[model samples]
Target: MIGQVKKMIKQCFFSQNNIKYVDYKDLDLIKKFLNPHARIMSRKKTAVGARSQRQLAEAIKRARFMGLLPYLSR
Candidate 1:
């Protein structure tokens, strides 16, 4: 274990809440992944896995299409 650096793992929101699906209608949850400028956060920033990040992006897009979320924020 010499010179082996330990990486800290951050827990994902879905896993913590025991959520199975990413829902577009859940504005609160979706907002958490979006930045103040209304853009989706990166995986590194959100600390979410690849699959969850994809799902989150899809949900955000769907929400915006349905007029639930804003495309841009002031």
Candidate 2:
């Protein structure tokens, strides 16, 4: 009960860490936002707000374009 409430009150990673921008060079971090199909995860599912979600998507796309992240999985 207490754990659930504490978890609910905690904010998302970016907000909690005060990260203003997502870095395209951080493929290890950005890859977490992508699914097995190489699709960006939805805000509802990822528990991120609209702004963060958009930034995350852009970072992922940039990483993919730069060949840092994979376009598809085997």
Candidate 3:
């Protein structure tokens, strides 16, 4: 479940954008952009940190999208 949510968030925000900065207000839009699974994960993970999640999510998304992980080739 968590993995699916992470994937959805990646597909929505990371896949589409090349920018680093995201507005707090824009979080709603980004939330809508994520898949249902990701929505759940986002909600659950919200308590982890306010701004850090966005940054971490963005980084993970970017990394996955770029095919930078060696194991991803498999």
Candidate 4:
């Protein structure tokens, strides 16, 4: 169920340019899809588990309310 939700969110937010924003609610949905024990072990990985988790939190803050497009633009 969570995987499906995550896939939907990814398809909705990451795949489309028109979707410039995501909310905390949306982030929560994504968090539900994450594995708690996952760990990041890289310096140049796109989405390295735990590190990506942290990045996701920050990204959610930037994407939510305001939007992700501007940040991606930079």
Candidate 5:
């Protein structure tokens, strides 16, 4: 294993998809960042950048406020 070179892969979804804006109405995308408990996942867990993570959090909060997404899991 001494000669093995670890490959670092970027797993940022927004970067891969070229999404500049995070939309609260996009349940599919927003749901990906939420855990079963309806909490926002951490940046390390989601592999999202700092800025994108903030945007995601804001969108999720907005969604919850608008009753589009649940505040807590059932």
Candidate 6:
């Protein structure tokens, strides 16, 4: 017989600290929400609320425009 295990999603960054803003300058933090391919993680995957997800998307775009984050991997 075999048993199945379930993994729980972690709390969102903003939610955990009650952060109201997602800054583009925080590359280290933002990058965590992006996959190795450079695509944004979905709300379901990040376990973030709708509002925070939108904020995160906007921040990522800003960072990309400023050349802080790569749009895609080579």
**Best lDDT among the predictions, by candidate number:** 5
Candidate 5 global TM-score: 0.89
- Colliding residue pairs in candidate 3: 5-38
Candidate 6, residues 2-71: lDDT per residue as tens digits? 4576667688778898989999998988998999899999987888878889999999999999999999
Q: Which stretches of candidate 4 lie over 4 Å from their true place?
A: 1-48, 67-74
Among the numbered candidates, top TM-score falls to: 5
Q: How should the candidates be ordered by TM-score, best one leading? A: 5, 1, 6, 2, 3, 4
Residue 29, model 4: Cα distance from true site in angstroms: 12
Clashes of each: 0, 0, 1, 0, 0, 0
TM-score of each model, paired residue for residue: 0.83, 0.77, 0.31, 0.26, 0.89, 0.82
Residues 1-74 of candidate 2: C-alpha lDDT, one tens digit per residue: 77666535535677877878999997777878789988888777777777888899899989889988878886
Residue 63 CA error for candidate 3 (Å)? 1.1
Residue-level lDDT tens digits of model 3 in 1-74: 77666533423333355545654345454454345544224635433343545665564465445543221221
Off by over 4 Å in 1: 1-8
Which 10 consecutive positions of candidate 2 have the poorest summed lDDT?
Answer: 3-12
Candidate 5 C-alpha lDDT tens digits along 51-73: 89889999999999999999999
Identify the runs in model 5 with alpha carbons over 4 angstroms from their true place.
5-8
Per-prediction CA RMSD (Å): 2.7, 3.3, 14.8, 12.9, 1.4, 2.8
Relative to the unseen true structure, what is the C-alpha lDDT of residue 44 in candidate 5, on a scale of 0 to 100? 81
Off by over 4 Å in 2: 1-10
Higher-ranked by TM-score: 2 or 5: 5
lDDT score at residue 43, model 3, on the 0-100 scale = 33
Candidate lDDT values, in order: 0.90, 0.81, 0.45, 0.40, 0.92, 0.89
